[model samples]
Target chain A: MFKLIESDAPQRRRICEIFVDGEPCQAMIGEPLAAALLKANCVPMRYTPVSGAPRAPLCMMGVCFECLVEVDGTPNVQACATPVREGMHVRLIHGARSIGQLGGAAQ
Target chain B: MSTFDVVVIGAGPSGITAALTAANRGLRTALIDEQLSPGGQIYRNVDAVDNGMQTILGPEYLHGRTLTTRLQHSTVTRIQGASVWQISDDLEIAYLQAGVSKTLSARHLILATGAMERPSPMPGWTLPGVMNAGAAQIMMKTAAAVPSGDVVLVGDGPLLLLVGKQLLDAGASIKGLIQTSPIAQAGKAMRHLPKALLAPGYLIKGLRLLTHLRAGRVPFFRTDEAVNILGSDRVRGVSFIHKGQRIELTVDTVLLHHGVIPNVQITRMLRLEHRWDVDQQTWKPCCDGHGRSSNPSITICGDGAGIAGALAAEASGAIAGLDACFALGNLSEGERQKLVRRPARAHRRQLRIRPFLDTLYRAPEWLSAPLDETVVCRCEEVTAGQIREMARLGCKGPNQTKFFSRSGMGPCQGRMCGLTVSSILAAENGVSIEETGYYRIRPPLKPIPLLALSQARVARSAGTERNSQPNEDPTHE
Candidate 1:
């Protein structure tokens, strides 16, 4: 319900289905994955790790990492930066993410 | 490593212009950007945005279309969707593209990486529906999306008014516009009117936008006090004092802005010398008029150089491009001067209104040094009080504060919280922002997969082995 404006501009029809938090959602091919999710009313994209606070896409540009979400098994991927693809799986990041053993203990 | 005569990082107004100028001057240029297409934030999705949206964005946005087209047609090697993670002092640029880490070298590197909205650290700013006004503009420009329900715009600056007007035209229901610019600043801003009139187009556009906002019947409040966003999980309402009266608006979305500062992550990471701009109250790289930074090979242009707006960025970019060409012996001194004369005049003219604007919309101190409870660093969840306490306890500077509180050590690499932390430290410690200093930037500038880095290293070594002379150590040099 947060989609205020409806564009009459020609848009590529929704040609792909992606999973958001294990739920299948229709998305337009080649659009930002965040836009697709926002259109689907996925407002709270992720929860901050420290405060457990809900956060959504702030700057769709890559500068503000508030849009950080897990995409296709990769944690902390920016939803706004990633283009939607067929069968893309996006999961809401709940808390602090470990960069696995390879990221080193300091990070 | 693939090397080019010039490597332009960014595809915005300045980067595109720089690349075009360099390539046209017979330099082997490579233009790199993180977006899938050209046209940085100001003209995002320029090629794809429809005519209706174009009208809403105005002529400034339309200008990018021509630039994008020209860059696309140019001989410059265009690299889109590249997240540049590192730039060594030796002009080695490393980036991640399609899950692959690659490195390239350039003789002359032009950084046109533009500005970002100043960090707004008011209470409840970290709420879900709370975001930068520029973010809302990006939503409209890139995704053809707008926030539904009651939206309250908070803060001040030219961008706030622009976004508010655009939102109104796009039919978004703005509950109220809370202008944080103090009423007294208007009188101060008037001092530069004669100089500002030199660029009449911008003045006219600004007046027109104001007229539209006034006609749209949106409630406007001018105040200097802090506006508190109310919500736990998401923005529910905004409460503030306006004209000696308290008012609260029920709103689901809150857009905040307080002007923009250069996105200096890459520049800082390169360890270039930077100076604090007292007027802008931000650290910008020390560069000559032609945009050449402390590093002779690296040139900083556009908003990345400083917030001189898009027109100045374009002009400065051309000047920088020509300077690089001259440095490379591509142009004679006389020819370079001739080429720079026009852009220099235009750049100066475009910059005429900035002093007045910067003075008029100077962010109130409270916005930067929010209340104790307000979160200062979103990544680390460091509160303003916590940062202040550390500063008082002899934290010294941003780098020291980082060790004490881990504020700037998050994924954002101090982008979101650097300014706030530094200013708060400066304020608390009774020192200038320069003395308080900034985060010691490190690389990889952005997060990159370890596997990709290893693969890139392997590829680099393989290429070196294949090309090295019998007695030469390719890795050493």
Candidate 2:
């Protein structure tokens, strides 16, 4: 797993726990959720809807949406753009996201 | 709605410099950016990057610290972490921040939106482990993390070499450095060496990077092309042709980069006239020597105007800022000219080595026109084959292809695939990429939730009576 280089600069680490695919993972408080996941060796953040192929964050700058994952029940959240918070819930997106109630007929 | 004399659309070096200049000229200025900090991508998190990483990023990045500090002290109002969605003809900007949609008006707009790594779409590029070299650098800059395991650097350009050297310096195992520039180009590239040496610092720095790589004994391959990425679910290996012989390297991570192209979404949305730069092989807004666009009210500076690197970007920003001041009657014509003299000369000098660099790292035509099976748009899963088929079936342009196959209609709004699609259409239709055109950018440039839009409208409506005349001329007073 990739870890940050130990720096002589004073460490301002903010420890927090986040749930990834139902597993509890430790993360920095304000670090990008995607970076934290990669540090934990979480490859294949999601599966492409078209081919059911695994994909991970390519551009951590949020230009590429390869790191899209469901965060706290919100679908299509860019993990690279979103920051990690305490008790944040992140779910690995599987193949072909469903549109949910937004696509359903009005009741 | 809040109004200002100038609204700089990005907080990078150019945008910050513009804002600082405008504010120093006593114009009400507003600077908006999507990142939480100022410094854009090149010097991202300049203030927060640890000293250890500082040594890795080099002095160019340290320059951002001074710009950021000046911006913080200036009178310009900074709205960080805001995504600008729409820009109107009358210089009105609609943006979303913290789930609140807001609109601001400016008499003049300076777009310093900067650049994105040119899309290198190849076989297996869509795999998980394949990423842009710039992306990897961003991770290192922002997160202080480097990719573990065997990482292979691919493609051409200064960034490829710089990142390879950085990763090796950081004690990461690199499998190889695959250069896509044909070996013969080196002889041609040297023809401009005398002119390039005029900017001795850049040439020396580049030479130093190359020397370091050689000293590290990093296996370098002058491959004719990066033909394919060999992987099933993730990047397992990469295949390229070196001297008419196929070679393969097994690796866990593959970082690719060709060069950078202007992020022209905002400028295109504003419908400003853009000219295709043949040497750079990208479409950039038509701006004058001082960064004034075809539309007098709008100006484009920095890499968004053209790829002239950071120093040129800052110089352009200063010129645009002074020009905007003169336009707003804040500075007299004589004073503006006198102020811009230094920056103008510096900007010209910074552009001295561009011809040499452009020739040395010209992206091969095949990289732009990827193999038919390679996926062009990752958002919509549109492939080169599908785009070509659409072109053959009388698809006039990218917009038509969008309807037929949904190529640029994804969350990225064609940022990732626009250039590739245009190149394919141009090649198939026997026209220049300029004639092929780009995706028609519309409102809501960044994704905003439905709830936010409604709430913003309601809040604005409530304040309409108090600040009703958002379009009122600020100079009239």
Candidate 3:
């Protein structure tokens, strides 16, 4: 579990609401989506296809693929690399994502 | 496709200094980084942080703001949130930004991708509540976040103590610090004390971090045996030997780290010659004192080149920047030599203490070579036993293990498991880690979506059309 601590100096950024697993969650505008999710206690960002083991962000620097979450219907987005956008739809990925999931278009 | 005179690939201390130096010399430089802001991992989000947070992060972190602020006023282009997926030997770069693919051709390239925490795999490390201590620090820096429940820090290195102190100062209810440093190596490390005394600031700072934790009266433990981050879905507790007797402590989060290694995936993808450093116990791309790699056009600096700390990275970057200016004909060779003297001296002073620190914090063997059932490859859920079995079955190295068990073939492309797998294979075969070569890293360093991959062609064609017919109506799109 994680909590967002108030800095001694007041924050000067905007806050926005994003959807996490179909639930409304408040997130800082332009901060990492993974940080927002972790603040909301939304761990286990992905399930492994091989053994179905639950995983969350290991290396927040994007070296580990453990935090691959489906963002706005696009599967396999690195949560740490992705910034929080207003009304962004983020769903935890389950196993190997099918190419046809959500509204994906072929290359 | 060419857009800039020089393109720097990261915005860490090194990249920031490099870009600033190049731009100051009249080179149209652009710095591409994956972070939301400049100040790669070491000083990440340094500009956004306020004065109150500054004191908590320490003077070293505040050092980044000077560079970031300087870059903000410079003519250099700072492209944020860019995932550089491909870089060619000829200096063609492709990166995905906001789901759009863009390409840049550069006369010179500086890769300062920086370092990543050496994954010291322990049992149940794949659990949800487990993470790199560096990750927690990033969250704290970028989001003002901190662990709310009971936290346990596992592993060795000064970073572990620094993180423990930072988290404790941030009000984390740290359970205990489980040290995995090979204390047996302290004698060897002591032999380097005279040389380390040349750089007194770092040694004192490391002790200060430890002293801070000790003053806080936080519980500290050292483990010689294997540690188990006991949990099913998330971290529930930790199981390890406290003092010849196995003990279990209930905990909510487990942060593991064993120092950091050069993030050489970019260099490896470029097919640069790399050597396994016996001291650092990791793969480092071969580069000169001035940060020139095998490819003449590409320059490497900062921790990405090796495991030199942030201070050394900046000095190395300054020296590299001077060399680049000389190469681009912006500075005379004599002038470049004259300018490089100060930063070169600073780089040497910063690196003088590395041997003492490296030997003191060498990660124990048990941290990497976990029990047979312990999961080593987080992506594929491959166990340590599977890797050893593959080695016994005559898998030459980490590459062959990929075909035999798919340990290193997942989305991460072996960043998390590559080093650990090498250690496992080396132990199983009784060969040196240098002989057990690393996985062959390929392009698309960061995985790109198929849509973005296709966008590369579209972006390139549009650029070609615009350049080929300059007189035609510019609004044809």
Candidate 4:
């Protein structure tokens, strides 16, 4: 698991609970979703569609879509680019996301 | 739909400077970026970063706050969290804002999109625990987070050394650093030392970072070998050769870096003339002294124009901004000439160390040109061997390789693997990278949702739309 060192210690950040794969994880408000997931030791954000190989945030920037995750039933969202919020729901992408799982539930 | 006299695509040092210069000069300017904050990646979360993080991230990063603070006081409109999906030649920009599509028109566009780490797709790079050194830098800059346990950084370039020092400062246990800068290349860099010494501060900083890494008890091995990250699904360790002897280290995470290159998605999509930069080993838009591309309406400054660090980008940004103002009739010929002198001089002065750096950490063919079983395109899962086979089949260029192997047709749109494929194909075809060429970039450049794209089409009102403005008519071309 990656270590988070008292992040943003000087600034009093609003901490909230977010659900990932139906499990509760503590997240800082407005922090990147990928960072929060990494801090929570939840790597392997997605599996490659071609080889089903597990992949995590490679660049932590938007360029490498290796950090693609499903948030609130929306598929292929970049966790590195998106911000965490209270009661946010995230799911790791297992290879190609079907339209059913995605459902485009959150616009 | 909103309109801007000048639309700056990136909010980094260069973009900010360009926006401020144009806005302060009475042109309507809007600076857009994907980050949640004002500063781009170099200064990610400048305002939110605590004092502790600031000390750990170092002074160069802290310097971003000054630019952002000045940006806050300026009249420039700062738009954050917007992923620009498309940029037309006519300066019609379409982007996704909070999951919805928004289109804006601009008289002039300045893209300070900045530089991205060169894609080093060695064996096991697609694994979960292996990432770029810049990613580690990003994690630290944004959240003060670091990989725990044994961490090994493998590659060459000033960024690798800088990240090693930063990770050590953040209290991360760096198990080792495997530098792949060839000894022969190091000898070549010696020739450029005199010219590089003109910018002594850069060399001094390099020395300081190396010293810090040494003081941290981190082992360093400069191997003229392509380092391999050995793992089934996650990084277990790294194995490489040193002096005809194989050396291996146990590690939890592997970070790779080999300098950075201009991010040319916008320029490529616009089809502005690009030349393969042999020194930096990447494609850069052919721009004038003021960063103006073949398309006079667009200007690319900063690393997006080329990898001329932050200070150089700031100067180039000023030049680009001043040029834009002059083009838009804000400054007379005499006024523009006088205003351009300082930034122009500063730009040249700041880039004095580039040749030394480019040669010292040139992109190693052995590292980037992967072989059988090594993945080239992450999205499509195309292997390097497959791409080589495509080249053997007489594929015309990178565009044909797309149909042959589906390498560049992934969701990432070839951002992660384009350069690697280019190198592999070039080597296989016995041609220079310049001759092999790069992937043909198109919109949506950043992978916007299909739903958003459809919605945007439905709500379209620009050049191609039904109620199009006469000035924005499709036949204007």
- Top candidate when judged by TM-score against the true structure: 4
Worst 10 residues of 4 chain B by lDDT: B457-466
Please provide, for model 3 over B378-441, each residue's C-alpha lDDT reduced to its tens digit, 9 standing for 90 to 100: 8888999999899989987999999888887889989989999998999999998878888888
Measured by lDDT, the strongest candidate is 3
Candidate 1 ranges with C-alpha deviation above 4 Å: A9-15, A97-107, B458-477
Local accuracy of candidate 1 as per-residue lDDT tens digits, A1-107:
24625656555444589999899988767778877777787877788888678888777788778888778777678888998999988888777765663221233
Write one digit per residue (lDDT tens) for candidate 2, span B107-154.
988899999898889899988888899888887787788888788888
- Candidate 4, residues B241-287, lDDT tens digits: the string is 87788998989899999898888777787778899888888889999
Q: Flag the better candidate by DockQ, 2 or 3.
A: 3
Docking class of 1: medium
Candidate 1: count of backbone clashes, pairs at least 3 residues apart or interchain = 0
Ranking by DockQ: 3, 4, 2, 1
lDDT of 4 at B6: 95
Off by over 4 Å in 2: A99-107, B458-477
Candidate 1, residues B1-477, lDDT tens digits: the string is: 899999999999999999999999999999999999998999888887744577788887888888899987899899999999877545778889988988898898899999999888888888888888998888777666778878999888889999999999988999888988767778988997888888748788888878899899988887678898898778889888887888999998999999999998988888789999988878899999889898888888899999989888888889889988987889999999899999899899899989888888888878767899988888899999999999879888999989988998888889999999988998999898888889988877888977777776432231122354566443453
Error of 2 at B5 (Å): 0.9
lDDT of 2 at B329: 87
- What C-alpha lDDT values do all the predictions have? 0.84, 0.84, 0.85, 0.84
Candidates 2 and 4: which is better by DockQ? 4
DockQ (C-alpha based) per candidate is 0.55, 0.60, 0.70, 0.65
lDDT of 3 by residue, A9-96 (tens): 5556568999988999999887789888998899777788787888889888889988888888787889988889899998887776
Candidate 4: residue B334 lDDT (0-100): 95
